[model samples]
Target: MNSIWVITKRELSSFFDSLTAYILLTVFLGLSGFFTWLYGSDIFFIGQATLQPFFSIAMWTLFFFIPALTMRMLAEEKRSGTIELLLTKSVNDWQVILGKFSACLALIAIALLLTLPYYITLSFIGPVDHGAVWTGYFGMLLMSMAYISIGLFASSITNNQIVAFLLALFVSVFFLIIFDVLAGNFTGSMGQFFNFLSISTHYESISRGVIDSKDLIYFLSISFFGLMLAETSLSKRNIVE
Candidate 1:
């Protein structure tokens, strides 16, 4: 088998083999659904078709869920020492990193798609801007991928899944919320840096139908930096051993 596909198959199988995958999907969707109905009042409050509430809620949900899902990616393998077995195989570091990344990316894509009924419901009940809805969803996916990549790197660093989860959660929370919050505390160009550094700011901006190339690059760059860091960790495992 090709190295990339081999690693991908391994990751996909692990996700499905565990009940947590189903649990995550159910919890994420169910929680988001409940919040949507509760907050949006099922669109009664807005009285128009808008997914702002949905994305607003989902941003919070993904913050926690991504860590939970990604905590075990490499951390558990290191815990069991099976990472050595995989390293002995034909796969290169990129293949391993990309494969693990692709599997989580696929999972996020599936979970995002499952929320389509909400969009359909909005479209049915009122005049909804489907373009904006789709754009928001796309922005959410891109942002989620970046978050997941951070979690993946965290997982790669340790043999303890809890540590990985906390590390990933901290990083995500910083980028997702703290950076934006700091914008208020900083001044001028420095504050602008925080706003630019704020994943939430960029994500919400793009989610609101203003998709900029810079925003896309921000998302992609974080994702790349994370994967590269994971590979770097894997490379250093020998020294630590």
Candidate 2:
């Protein structure tokens, strides 16, 4: 517990010490805000008194940014041989994974926090669907968690941050795009199964303000599977060296 918090704090401090956190936050907030207000399918274009545009943009923003954020979790540590030192501490493999995962989530949370003004502005302008807004944020957070876990797993399997980033993005693409495309191409039960596998489907479902147990299960299953793979990778490395 305490060990996990220590690692979390360490990772957070490291993020701020470098320019990673600031850059990611700025890019995330900027892109999201821009698309939500100015350029793309913005609120003015939608004219629905909903935060759906922001939510849609956020989902895409996280697809790229979360991978970049998690690319260094273990990949950089292993590259610099700090992972060996890290393993020698009182912390266990899961704690390290959880710590890193929590740090990434915290950073995403901060970025999300910065977008609160979007909601506030929407409320001031017109009638806003509070339920949808809440669920939209929840959906994005869950989607981000799944991506973060996948990114951490990708980071664990490689020693290069670039490789980790690409691998994470590759794996995430299946859930984000490929599966959805494949799902549409298929028919009957097969199409239904593929649609079930797509993260976008579940995200869209939850973003509409309906929280289903199946959606929760879907996100949790991916997150848990990714974290388990990461823990396995770390444990193997620890055993080898």
Candidate 3:
């Protein structure tokens, strides 16, 4: 646990010490704010008291932005031959993965927190569904966890940051688009199955201000599965070393 926190703090500090964190936060906030307030689907045009527009924009923005943020977590370490040095510090694979994951999540949480003014402004203009807004944030957090895990796994599999980014984007696209489309085209059990597998499906369910156990389970399960794969990949690298 201490090792994990040490790595987490180090990674988090490194993020702030470099331009990576700033770029990610700026782009994420800029796009999310633009689409939520200035774009065609702006809240004023929607005539709703909900943060649905922002949520919609956020979902798309995260799809691209998150991979960029996570692309170098392990890929760069491996490329620069620093992963071995990292491991030499009494840190196990799972601890390293968890530390990196926590750092990314913390960064994301900070980004999300910066958007609170949106909520505050929305509340002043109209009746905002506080419950829904809370749940929506929860859903986004879950979505981030899932993406971060997948992104970490992508990084673990390659020593090239660009390849890791592309692979993460490729993997995320399946959950973001392919599964959703397949779910729509299927029928009965097939539809149900695909829908169950779709991240958006669970996200929507939670965003409705209703926290379903199944939805929670789905997000956690996907995150866990991805992390386990990453751990396995790192273990293999250790064996090869």
Tell me which of candidates 1 and 3 scores higher on lDDT.
Answer: 3
* Candidate 1 Cα deviation (angstroms), residue 146: 1.0
Off by over 4 Å in 3: none
For candidate 2, write residues 44-77 as lDDT tens digits. Answer: 9978888988888888899999999999999999
Off by over 4 Å in 1: 40-42
Per TM-score, what order, best first?
A: 2, 3, 1
Model 2, CA-based lDDT: 0.93
Q: Where does model 2 exceed 4 Å of error?
A: 238-241
Residues 1-241 of candidate 3 have per-residue lDDT tens digits of: 9999998999999999999889889999999999898888799999888898888889888888888878899999989999989998887899999999999999999999999999999999899999999999999999999999999999999999999999999999998889889989999999888888888888887888989999999989889999999999988974786
The candidate scoring highest on lDDT is 2
lDDT of 3 at 185: 100
- Pairs of residues at least 3 apart in sequence or in different chains that clash in candidate 3: none
Error of 3 at 91 (Å): 1.5
Question: What lDDT is reached at residue 78 by model 3?
Answer: 87
Rank by lDDT, descending?
2, 3, 1
Global fold similarity of model 1 (TM-score): 0.95
Give the alpha-carbon lDDT of every model: 0.87, 0.93, 0.91
